[model samples]
Structures are given as structure tokens and as C-alpha cells.
Target: MSIVVPVYQGERTLRALIDEILPLTSRTYSPSGRPLVVEEVLLVFDHGPDGSADVIRELVSDHSFVRGVWLSRNFGQHPATLAGMASSGGEWIVTMDEDGQHDPADIGGLLDTALDRQSSVVYAKPTNAAPHGLWRNAASRGSKWLIATAMGADSTVSYQSYRLVLGEVGRSVAAYAGSEAYLDVALGWIAGEVTTSPVELREEHGRRSGYNVRTLLSHFWRMVLSSGTKGLRLVSFIGVAFAILGLVLVLWVLASYLLFDVGTEVQGWASTMVILLFGFGATLFSLGVVAEYVGVNVKTAMGKPPYLIVADPADGPLGRTATRPEPPEHTTPT
Candidate 1:
């Protein structure tokens, strides 16, 4: 089994997180009574100004299973995580936060659930998930709700990356390259037997998350846009429903003029103005949704990579590192 952690400015607790994980390696049986031999720990160090890259390099000198992949720059958490998973070699892959919030002790439970339930993905749902400020919590839940509305309730299982994935399944997810990849939604597509278990979450030791409100909002938009056809379908339904209603209202107005002469004889232009504004606003919003889909296709056609591989060195704890692919000379088509 391998634990894939994407490290970014985690100078505070990287070492401690590794120590907590080492105990999982010593365990003989997984939560499901299967023999366990931790294969590796694939840590992708996202580009940061801090000494995190140096720390990862130092750790690689001694550990064979602790592998590191450095990006040229910060490509956001979802992209960095995809890069790490692409490089993992374990029969089972587990992705989690580098911050100490995701408890390593829960790894056993996740593994056990995966085997017993015969699930491709067993998630560590943070029942006691650590609380950020109240507003943060609300925003997080709001994000989840948005995803659930677009995807299905099944897809919004409230599972963070602190979950176990079958090796093949993980690779399948990594194969899904998108400019706006949402980790949770991608997992929902490939993972069957998706079950959630309670796990304890923790508070960060030193630094607050590098992700700001803008970043989170950006991520949310990408998630909704690139997730799948679900959002599009919802938007389409809404558009059609509005069109039908508008047509009905027009018909009613005409009928009133021809037959009873009610709403048509109303005093002023208030009703007409309200109708015009509502129609215009709804049309613009729906058009914006359609434009997002077009933008995704444009990016894919231009051959733009969802993320870049900056500085991946060979030889580390996870085994000898493999080289990342070089990007094409031209990022976009002329």
C-alpha cells in the first residue's frame, strides 16, 4: 500500500506526519484481516518559497519508500495530487493532506473497510473533522452542497483525500486529465463500493492553509465546470423550463387581450419591465454556464496540460523516482 501526500509549505509537520504513518507499516493485518506491507509514500512537494523542497530532499537520502516529486510552481492542490497519484506504485493508494488534520491512525480502518466491503474506494469521512472558523466551516459545507447538487448525493459523501484507493482505480482517476479537476468528483466516477467511515481530524500546528477564499472559490468553479455533464444537464433543464414558462406567459397575455382584457389593460409598464429584466438575467446566466463548457474544450484542444511537473528527482523512499514528461514547445494551437 502507498500513501500519496501532496506537500506544500508544510515545513511544520512533514516529519511528524511521516512518523505517525510508520506505525501503519508495522501492522500485519489491515482492518479487514488482510496482510499489510506498506509499499511506499509518494509525496509531491508543490512549488513554494519555503524550505519544504529542501526538507523533502533530505528525507529522500535515507528512506527508500519516501519518494518526492517537485513541481515548477504551485499548480493548486487537485493538480499536485493528481501528479503524485500518477507516480504511485502500490497495490493500494491513499491520498491525504500533508497537514496533520488527516489522522494516519485511521488508515487501518480505511484499509479494513476497503477489503471487507470489497470497495474500490474506502473514505475517511471526518465525523469529528476539525473545525476551521465558523465561516470557514459554513463555506466548506456550502461547497459540498454545491457539488452534491451538481453531481448526485452519492458523489458528495463528505470524504476528504484521506481515503484508500485500489491501485488500478487510482490510476484510472489520474488518467482523467482536466484543466479543472475536482478530486472528490473524479473519485466518484471510477470508484465503486464507495463507503465512508468516521475518523478524527486535527488542527494545524503552525501555518494556516495557503488556500484563501479566492482560491477556494476558484476551485469550486472548476469543480462544477469540469466535473461532468450533470451540471450542464441541470442548467439545460432550467433553461428549457424558463423558456416554456415565458412562452406560456406570452400566450396568457395575448389571450387576455383578445378575450377578457385583464393584464393587458394594466396601468403602467411595470409588468413588461419586470418580465424583460427577468428574461434577460436568466438568459445571461444560462449563457455563462454554456460558455464554461466551451472554455474547457478550448483548453483541451490547445493541448494545455492540467498541471506541470517541475522538479521530480529519482531515488527516494517510494522507490527510484521516474522522470516527469516534458511539455510541448507550444502550449496552444495557432
Candidate 2:
């Protein structure tokens, strides 16, 4: 097992986090008795304005399992996490933030959730409200609501930092993820089964959140774009609905003279202008969606993978063979 932590400004909190995690490595963490071990704790440094690099160096030198994965520059949280996953050699990988909001004690519950559900991935669902300002919490909920409505997605598609991923799936996603990819969304593409475990989030130990309002909004938009054809489908649906509405309006106009006359006694000019404005707005919105997709695809075409390995990972619960339940060897007569 590996814990891949993406660090932005964690100089003060990392030591405490590591100390908490170290105790677990010496004991059992899996309820299924699957023989799990914490082989590595990878702290990915994203070059923030702090002494994190120096702290990471000290941690690497102090603990045998602790290792530092440094990026050339700041590449944001998901990319830094992917970089760590790409380099990990463990059979399972757990991705969490460095802010200490995610408690280390809950890792055992994550493992149990995955094993009991026979799932490829398990996400942590906080039972209490997130430790953020009221407006920030509201915005987060609003964005999630918008995503679920627009994309026709279920609760499993929610964004979560504390997640346990199958080793092969984690590494494969890290390799093939596009430039603007969201980590959780990328995981959803191939994870055959996913579930969530309820946990309580602890407050950050007197630490300020790294994300400001503008940064959070930008991050949300990137996630929206990374949803992969969902936004485009939404636009398509809107366009179709508008076409149907226009057809109904046209039929109503025709019926006004032929049958029970209504909604067309006034001059047609006002209605015509309203129709024109609606059509133009829809057309421009569709064009904008298309342009956004084109730009993302162009980036994918240009960016090469950062890491490569000789072969696939060992078989786990999400393996092709594992996904299919085995038949009973014998059956009793009914």
C-alpha cells in the first residue's frame, strides 16, 4: 500500500500526518485479512511558496518508508498526485491532501469499504459539513448539484480527495490522463465498481486553505471540461428542445388562422425578434462548447506521457478475471 500526498504548503502539518500514518504501517489495516502493508508514503512537492521542499527532504531522510516526489514546477494537485502514483510500486494507492483534513485513522475504513463492496475504487464521503467558510461550502454544493443535473451522473461521481484506488488503475490513469483531466473523473472511466464510505472530516490544524475563490472557480470549470462529452451532450439536448419549442410555436401560429385562434393576433414582428434572439444565443453557446473541446483535444495531442513501464500490474479485485464472479464447482439437486 502507498499513500500519495500532494503538497502545496504543508511544512507545518506533514510531520504530524506522517507520525500518525507510521503507527498504522506496523499494524493491520485491512478487514478482509488481505495482508496489506504500507510500503511507501510519497509526498509530492508542487513547489509552493514555503519550506515544504526542505521539510520533505528532512522527512525523506528520517523515515524509511517516506519518500519525496518533486515536480519541476507547480502543476496543481491532481498532476502532482499522478506523478506520485506513476512512481509508486505498491499494490494499492491512497490519494489524500496534505492539509490534514483527511484523518489517517480512516484509511482502514477505506480498505474495508473497497474489500466488502468488491470495488475498484472507494471514495470518502464526509458525514459532517466540510470545514470551510459558509459561502465556500455552499458554492461547492451548488457546483456538485449543477454537475449531477447537467451530466446525468449519480452520487458516485462526486469529487473526493480521500480515495483508495487499485494500483493498476491508478498508474494507467496517471499515464493516459489528458492535460486538463480531473483525477477523480479519470478514475471513474475505468473503475468497474465504485462505492463510498462515510467518514468525519477533522478541521485543519490552524492552517489556511490554499485555494482562494478565483482558484476554486477555475478548478471547478476545469473539472466541468474534463467530464468528457457530458457538457457537449447537454448543449445538444438544449438545442433539440429549442427546435421542438420552435416547431410548437410555428404550429400554433398556423392554427390561429385555421382553428381556435390564439397567441398570434398581435403583430408577428415581436415574436419573430424573440425567436431570433433565442436562436442566436443557443448557436453561440454551442459554438463556445465546441471550441472548448477542440482546445482540450489539441492539448492532448501535443502532450506526451510522462512515465512508462514494461507491463501491466498484478491482478487485483479490478482485474478482468476478478471482475467476473466465479461459478460454483458443484451444485446440489433441487
Candidate 3:
């Protein structure tokens, strides 16, 4: 197994977190009876305002297992994490924050949960409240609930930063996931065997929390988009419902005017409004069509992959393609 921690303004707490993880480097074992060890601790620096790079360099020099993945710029936590996971080669990859909130000792329990349930991923559910204040915590919960309920990504409704993932699944997500892709949703796209373990989040030992309203909102919107086209479908449903209601109202007004038999003025006004509305709706429809094309172009520009491979092909021979049109001698060359 390996550990991937995304560091951002965490210079003060990085070493302490590593100290806790150092003890479990090779002495532990997973529930499957295999010797579990953190072969590498990847500290991904997202180029924050602190001196985290220097700290990562020092740790890399001190411990052979400690490696640093420095990004070109601040790409936020999820991107940095994806970078770290893409570079990892362990059978199981455990991602946690650089702060001391997540305990490294509890990793064994997560592994146990993964093995017992045959889960490809295991999220560490907080047994206690988060180490933040009320509004921040509330906003976080609200955003998660909205994403799960509104965006239809309930498979990852319980996702948290601290989780255990199969190494191959993690790497696959990193490879194909878009720049703004929500990490949990990308994992859900491939790994269907998901579970959660109870683990209390420890208080940050004097480390500052970098979370705020803006970051929370940004992450929420990304989650909604990366979850699929459920949001678009919801908008379509709402528009269609509203249109049906408007049509019914128009029919009622027309029926009322015709019943009076002396409502010529009102009828003419209604007809004029109807023509104007039709023209406006046609213009808006044209713009909507262009926007749909723009949306597709934007998604392509965002680097969202066309597809992702969760696992190897079934019954494929080792070091060979799955199928060939002709014989194996000259048939399967790509």
C-alpha cells in the first residue's frame, strides 16, 4: 500500500503527519493476511502560500520512502491528489489530508473494511463532527446533500478526502478524469464496490483550515458537473413542465374569451402576445442549440476522456491483445 497526501499551506503539520505514518511503514498487515506497508508517502504540493516545498524536500532527503510531487501551480486539492495517485504503484492507495486531522494508524481498519466487504474503495466516515466551526461544517454538509440528491451521485454521497482505493482504480481515474472532475465521482465512474469505515477526525493541532465559502461552492459545482448529465436533465424537465403549465394557462384564457362571445379585444391581444412569445422562444431555442454545441466543445477542451477502463479485459492472454481477426502470428497488431 501507499499513502498520498495533498499538501497546501500545511508546512507546520506535514512533518507531524509523516511522523505518525513512519511507524506503520512495514509493520502492519491487511485483513487479507498480506503484509501491509506504506511503501511510499507521496506529499503532493499544490503550490500554496507556505514553504511546503522546502518541507517536502527535507522529508524526501530524510526518508527514502517519502517522495514529493510538486505541481506547476495551485491546481487545488483534488488535482494534486490525482497527480499523486497517478504516480503511485502500490496495490492499495490511501489518500488523506496533510494536516493531522486524519490518523495514519486507522489505515489498517480501512484496509480491513475493504477486504471484508470486497470493496474497491473505502471512505473514512467521521465518527465525530469535523474539526471546523458550525457554518463551514453546515455548508459542507449542505453541498454534499445537494450534490447527492440533486445531481444523482448518491454512490459517492458519503465521500470524504480520507479514503482507501485500489491502486489500479485510482490510477485509471487520474489518467482519464477531467481537470475539474470531482475525485469521488471519477472513482464512482469505475469502481462500483464502494464502502465506508467509521473514523473520528482529530482536531487540527494549531493548523489553519484553508476552507471557505468560495472553495466549497467551487467544489460543489464541479461535483454537479462531473457526476454526469443529470443536472442538464433536471433543467430540461423543469423547462418542459413550465411550458406545459403555460400552454394550459393559454388554453384557459382562450376558452374564457370565446365563452364571453364579446371578448374580441382580449382575444386579439392574446393572439399578438402569442406571436411575440413564439418569436422569442424561437430565438432562445436557436441560442440554446448553439450553447449545446459550445457545451460539448467545452467538455472536450476540459480533457474529459471519452471512456475509462476499470479493469482488464476478461480471458485476455498475458502481454497480448484480447482478440485478433486472424491467427496470433500476424493478426493482433495494433
The residue-by-residue lDDT of candidate 1 on 257-314, one tens digit each, is 7898465345538877897888788878888888888888888888777677755543
Per-residue alpha-carbon lDDT of candidate 3 for residues 103-171, written as tens digits (9 for 90 to 100): 988898899898888999999999899989999888888878887677776645488999999999999
**Model 1 lDDT on a 0 to 1 scale:** 0.78
Give me the candidate number with maximum lDDT. Answer: 2
Q: How many clashing pairs in candidate 1?
A: 8
What ranking emerges by TM-score with the best candidate at the front?
1, 2, 3
The numbered model that scores best in TM-score is: 1
lDDT per residue for candidate 2 within 189-244, as digits (tens), equals: 89988889888998997689999999898788887898879889878987999999
Which residue runs does candidate 2 get wrong by more than 4 Å? 29-35, 252-274, 304-334
Q: What is the TM-score of candidate 3?
A: 0.79
Collision pairs in model 2: none
Residue 173, candidate 1: how far off, in angstroms?
A: 2.2
Superposing every Cα of model 2 onto the true structure, what RMSD results?
17.6
Candidate with better lDDT, 2 vs 3: 2
Worst 10 residues of 3 by lDDT: 306-315
